[model samples]
Target chain A: MRVALDILIWVLFAFVIIGAIPVAAGAYQFLLIPFHSFKNHYSKARPHLPRVAVLLPAWNEGAVIGNSIERLVKLSYPAGRLRIYVVDDASTDDTPDVVLGKAAKYPGMVFHLRRQKGGEGKAHTLNHGITHLLADDWMEALLIMDADVIYREDSLRRMTSHLGDPKVGAVTAYIAEGSADPNYLTRFIAFEYVAAQKASRRAQNVLGALACLAGGAQLHSRENLLAIGGRIDTSSLAEDTFTTFNTQLGGRKVVFEPHAVVLAEEPGSIGALWKQRLRWARGNVQLTQRFHKVWFRPSKVHRLGSISFGLFWFTTFLLPVAMILSSIGLIGLYFLERELASTVFRVSWFLSACTYVFLTLYTIFLDGPTGRRSWREALLFPGIISLLVMIMAFAPGSLDHWLPGLFGLQVTEVGQEIWTLSVYAWLSLSMVAAWLVKKVESTRIGRMLSPLLIYFVGYGALLCAITFDSYIKEFQGAAQVWDKTEKTGRVAA
Target chain B: MSGVHRPGVVRAERVTGVSALTGLDQAELSQGEATDRALTDEALWREIAHNRRAELRLVPEALLALLVVAGLIILREVYFR
Candidate 1:
């Protein structure tokens, strides 16, 4: 019995160390973001503007189609040079009529094509548009975009300018959340987008290999598109990611043009966000399967095969699982021995908090108003998620109740009580930190309290719980459904 | 916020040597130049930022801060008692 207990403790310790590896690496990467931003060099020059075809894929997008079409037609790019092709995927709504109306306004420039039998998917709609556009040899570049996304006037020009360099195969603009009436969820997403686009994408640009290009604003050169066989892939829910990899695989450089900004409406509710992110999570898993060779034998040819890109994707997929296991293991370890567990958990949590603080600061500094105004979203970053997971973790009827029986682990009554209390205590502390950060600001006491608040939130362990749930759903061969983020035509210009 | 013009026509002022790819294998042709430029630029920036440790300069600082803070937390939890 003694030997078994000792062995179990050692295994738990090993799990904690193994789990800390990815979290530490992620922290280091976050630390690298600010310096990368500082090194950003911009040069102003008149770029060669190529004849571009914009492929706007629509399906029941009546709410935003008119605005999107108008925005595209009024783009700063020359009317004769920039052609808008809206492929309406058999929408029962007035999307077709809206596109046709716009097409009439911009005669010969904006054209609308409707599929008789539609609703296959966005990827199919894009492919339908791509096929028709490829027939016209005059188009030097093609912009694959959605019907709901509104691009800034110079966005198309900035994206097209990258094509001036022949080495550039594709360029993607940053997609900012344009929710007119901001809710907590949308605000959090807005902050997340800043971190993702500003920090992560910039770091990727510096590395010369991007993890994935933004779906809304991808500009592909005609030649490179042809090299990849001229159709948007329909094999994965993440067709944009598929296309991004294909461009790199076809020996062309994909660039992230940050200056080109596009505003998109994101899901505003938790349920909606969950559905949307689940599709993305599942698509990533599918991407891993589809591009297994990229991992098995990484080479220069497949840029996705490169170390930075590959590790980033792999770690992102596995971190949640690792985190969940480690968290549970630590809780269990704490029940057996308090001092041993406290040191490990505190250290890991502290490192994660550092990463979180650095990311929030850099993301806020990079983007202006949205970052500053929505800064409170950072406090709730993982705090809310952590609270949810803690409730789930300790719920009487949930998975925790079955743990002892399922794992055949010996837990004294006192140990179990202590473990539950400790978890709740940690969660309460995190909530308090979040509350302080959200309520207190710019005061002397606020400044003093800020670091501890930042420390308490750490990498919201609840995010890991969410990811783990997604992982299980994907692993169970859950149906791959495109849960579209419902758009309300409420975007801030 | 710019003026619209004709398609496929490059204006005199806008036209530059880097306007478009001249070769059929434009993708491969431009790879060497872009890669070399990016690599050299990255190196220079790294050296200027912090010689030999530019990219990871913050790691040590963050790690140290984390350690010191975590040490205090652990001391409060365990050693203080």
Candidate 2:
């Protein structure tokens, strides 16, 4: 029995180590960002502006469609070579009117295509445009974009230039959250994008295994699109990811153009953000199953199956599971061996603290303007409670001393033991806190308290909670409903 | 045409018997010349230079971050123990 318990303790420690892998992977990804200059495909890129067709899929986007079209028309590409096609997904609003008006105004540059039967999904709408564009020989490249996003003047030119390299199939731009008057939620999202899109995608470029193209700012060469069946994948919720994987699997390179900036209006509330990310999380779950054979199975065709890429993918996919398992391991160890549990907790969290500091600083340096604006959000990404836990890990017993001293109290042995156990349990408790943040957001005082709850629980924890929910929904075979995030024209020109 | 005027090049023709052109004409000429300058060899080289400089700047910062992390770990090991 003693030997068995010892073996179980060692197994628990292994789970703690497993949880640290994703944190280490995140830091590693950021460390790879500077090397992008050497490994990127820019050497093969040139200023090649093909006859480009911009596909905007709109479903009742009247509020933003007109402004979006105006911005597309004013893009710095040659006026003759660029065209806009807005696929109206049977919008009940004045979307068709706005689009038709723009079509009339821009004449040859803008055209409106309507679907008599709509509400199927974004993929179906995008396919409708793809079919129409492919029917003609005029378009040499296709730019897939959301209706609410505003492209910078030189963005299209920068993106299309990569098509100059015949081997490059697709290009994705840096998508910045562009809510003009961003609240707390948008700021958090903005900082998250700086990390996810700007910093992480740069690392992906170096690895030569892009996980997914930005759904709102993907540009594809016509030949490459036709090679991948000429239409978007309508079966999965993650059509963009499917297309990205298919493009790479077909023996072509997908490049991330950091200079090409697209501004998108992200969700402004917790409920809204939850819905948006839940869809994404579910899609990721679907994709993981769909491409089960591709992971960790190296192929001559693509690097999607490479060990490094697979680690990055699975680490992110299984992060919530890892967090729960780590907590369980620590708690189990505590019952068997208290000293060992304490040491393991300190070591794991110490690694997490290092990752937290390195990634926050590196992300800030990656984009100065966004770094300046969302620095607060960046700092509090792991949540205030997690931050305290990190501090406690860094300086063992310091929090016990300082926190009690602040309240003019002494720490008893029992209280200290309980506190230690609480810290061990916090790994999973943070996810619970995150779910409570969503619950609070739906309450009468949601608008007032939810943001505060988020700061206390942390945005990263919130995302993990959403991913956990996705795992449940997928396991239970929930119906895949296309929940479109309502867009307000908050993006600045 | 043989010496100065190439197929894709535009040369000044001593307008108003003066070698120097007016500001408006120069501006117009620069606008036409801009197309040639777009994404030229010099521009691509400039982009490469910028990337190199960015990489150089980042290396020191990344190194400093590494040192900080190492310092924290060392401090915990030495002081806490």
Candidate 3:
């Protein structure tokens, strides 16, 4: 019986170590990102701009459609060369009218096509637009853009600059959250985009395999598009991912152009963010289902089979599930035996913490001047990662003893396993506090306190809660449909 | 409306359209259902196999797990005993 019990403890300990693999791998990847700066692959600039068609898919996007059209009009590309196609997906609102208004003003430059029966989804709408564009082969390339995303004046030029390379199939730009006075949720998204796009995607680029092109800011060469079937896959929730993989599967490179920045309005509320992230999470799960063969036995023909891409993609979909299970298992083991569990937990955490510290410094270094200025955010990153690791390792309720003592309150539960749910729930208020302080930032106190809360719990714990919920939903195989994030046109041009 | 026990009959409707710009008729192309790649039992099993294979490839991860577990065992032997 004692031997059996020992075996059980060992098994649980193994689970904890296995679960930390994703986090360790993730930190390692971030650490490697900065090294890519020295190895630059420079492609010569094109002598002249390619004739490009911008495909905008809209469904009930009346709020930001006009602004989007205006932004497209102001793009640095030649008006004679670039054509904007606004494909209205049977929007019940005034979306068609707005496009028609723009079409009337721009005449031949801007065109409108409406899908008679709508809700066919973004991929189908894009296909409809592609069919229209294919009728005239005058366009050399196409840009698949979301209606709410606004490209900076030079962003289009930068994104297409890489298309000069004959081997490059598609180029994706960084999509930054663009609310002028962003709330806490948007601010978190802002920091996340910097890490994901500016850091991670750049790292992937060094390996010649990018994970996925941003659906909002993808530019595909006309030849490359036709090579991998003219239409986007309508069956998958992640049509963009399918397109990205297909582009690579057809023996072409999809490059991430970090200089090209597109401003997009992300969801502002937790509920909205949850729905959006759930759809994204489910799409990733579906991608794994669809491309299991690609990962299992990657052929030389399929460039998406690279180790870097596979590691990022699989960990993204599976880590949260593993973390939750390992955490619970650790808690159970702790209840059975105390010192044995503590020693193992501390050792594992020490290794994870060192990785986190290295990753945080590397991320800040890669981020350049702006990142350095926001050192507060960078400093909080290690703490955030450590706290998350602790929570996932079933941090004892005694951990809260530190917090209560610091706040001068009595601790209620000692040495009990504290489920992170309550901690996250209570900590979510920092998001509110950050938003409130930001709103009142004209005052002295607001200016001093807002950035701290914004970086600490507002960005950190709130994001974890949303991510944890997404993992739970995906694990349960919950029915997921694309939930359009509401855009209020608060983003500046 | 009174109903009796009778053979159930189902009716189907066909819809088609021609694009004004491209002049291409839909026929069955647009109307037909997209490929149903719904996660099947076979596909799920295949995915499980794929993940298992992936685990075999993760030698470093396996080593990390073993080392950590071994540490705990040693700690138990040294201190608790």
The TM-score leader among the candidates is 2
With candidate 1 superimposed using the best TM-score fit, by how many Å does residue A463's alpha carbon deviate from the native?
A: 5.4
Residue A450 local lDDT, model 3: 52
Root-mean-square deviation of Cα positions for candidate 1 versus the true structure, in angstroms: 10.8
Residues B1-81, candidate 1: write the lDDT tens digits.
123323334411322333332221333224344332322323223322332233344345445545654564465446333
Give candidate 2's error at residue A216 in angstroms.
0.4
lDDT of 2 by residue, B1-81 (tens): 011112111211224433221121233224234432443344444554454455456566677777777888888888875
On residues A1-493, what C-alpha lDDT tens digit does candidate 1 reach at each position?
9999888888877777766667666655565554544443222112445668899888889999899888887676545567899999888998988889988888878899999988677899898988898776767788988778999976876676566567778889999999788876677788888777866786777666777878889998888889989998897778888898888877788887676789999876444665677677777778878878777356666566767666667777787656545766676677677677766665665555545555556566667687777787765566644534433432323434555668887778887777555553453344344434534535678656654554346334333444565678877977767667788798876
lDDT of 1 at A441: 35
Model 1 clashing residue pairs (backbone): none
> Taking the tens digit of each residue's C-alpha lDDT, what string does model 2 give over A1-493?
9898779988998988888889889887888977875777767765465668999999999999999999988776556567899999999999999999999998988999999999889999999999999897778789999999999977887787677778889999999999988999999999999889888888888888999999999999888999999999999889999999999999999999888899999999888888889989999999999999999999998889999899889899999999998999999889888888888888889889999988888888778899899999999999999999998888887786789999999888899889878888887999998898898787788778988888988999999999999999999989888899999899988
Candidate 3 has an interface RMSD (Å) of: 22.1
The whole-model C-alpha lDDT of candidate 2 against the native structure comes to: 0.84
The C-alpha TM-scores of every prediction are: 0.75, 0.92, 0.73
lDDT of 3: 0.66
How should the candidates be ordered by DockQ, best one leading?
2, 1, 3
Any residue pairs clashing in model 3, and if so which? none
Candidate 2 chain A, poorest ten consecutive residues by summed lDDT: A42-51
Order the candidates by lDDT, highest first — what do you get?
2, 1, 3
